[model samples]
Target: MANTPGAKKAARKIARRTEVNKARRSRVRTYLRRFEEALSAGDAAAAKTAFVEAQSELMRAVSKGVVHKNTGARKVSRLAAALKKLGGSAA
Candidate 1:
């Protein structure tokens, strides 16, 4: 429904960006789910490893503007807390 050429190009750009963002979001969720699974399995070592990876991915998302800075920080904080409760270090 774009009337102008510029509008059509903008729509295409938006569609591409949306696809990229969705992929990024799904990647983050996959990492988070892995972390949660490790936690539920009662494997401190595995959970720590997953937490590290998930935290890195989350921060990367924030840097890419896919996630808000505060939101990423909050998710990391909560995950760290859960990791700690599992007798794992936040490192």
Candidate 2:
């Protein structure tokens, strides 16, 4: 359906961008999951570290336009609160 040269190029770009965005989103999910698992396991240190790393990864997603800025901020806030509670009790 993409007959024109510009259209063909645009289609290719879209395909490549889609694949990149998918990978980025998956990576962000992996980081978030790590934090969750650590928190659930009651590993305060691990959970704190994971939360920091996940926050960075999430901010990167926002920068890449894969996620909204406020969404990232909200997720980070919730996760940090979880980490705080876990760490506080464990300490």
Candidate 3:
């Protein structure tokens, strides 16, 4: 219960931020899923494209504070490794 006016406003702000963050997280996940699907399908070109998009989205999320910097880097690294293992150069 937010009794104080400031507290109520803070709660509202938090709710709005939560929604935005959730959307950003979902977007990142969607990009990641696309990359995974491309990889699994063994489409080198599509996988490369998806990897770039996923890495971009992840970095954007990290910059927006939706994800930690190290975490984002780690995920990108793993994705690159997977792409490499799939015979694609993650340039």
Candidate 4:
């Protein structure tokens, strides 16, 4: 319950930011899932492609303050490692 006018405005701002962040989060997840699926399918070409796109999207999210820089770096690192291992196992 927001009794004061400023408190009500703050609540509204929070709601708006939540919606924006939710969309950003969902977008990042979708990109990550695409990369995972490509990796699971053992398609190096597709996985690499997906990885590049996902990396770009992740960095964008980081620049927009939607995700932390270290978080994005870790995600990209893990995905790249998985992709590399996928090729190694196939060889």
Question: What are the models' TM-scores?
Answer: 0.97, 0.91, 0.99, 0.89
Off by over 4 Å in 2: 88-91
The whole-model C-alpha lDDT of candidate 1 against the native structure comes to: 0.98
Q: What is model 4's C-alpha RMSD?
A: 3.2
lDDT of each: 0.98, 0.90, 0.99, 0.86
lDDT of 2 by residue, 1-91 (tens): 8999999999999999999999999999999999999999998888978888899999999999999999999998898888888763312
Best by TM-score: 3
Model 3, range 41-88, lDDT digits (tens) per residue? 999999999999999999999999999999999999999999999999
lDDT of 4: 0.86
Which stretches in model 1 have alpha-carbon errors above 4 Å? none
Ranking by lDDT: 3, 1, 2, 4
lDDT of 3: 0.99
TM-score of 4: 0.89
Best lDDT goes to which candidate?
A: 3
Which digits, one per residue and each the tens of the lDDT, describe model 1 over residues 1-91?
Answer: 9999999999999999999999999999999999999999999999999999999999999999999999999999999999999899996
* Winner by TM-score between candidate 3 and candidate 1: 3
Candidate 4: the clashing residue pairs are none
lDDT of 4 by residue, 1-91 (tens): 9999999999999999999989998999999999889988878888888888898899999998999999988987887788888883221
**All-Cα superposition RMSD per candidate:** 0.6, 2.5, 0.4, 3.2
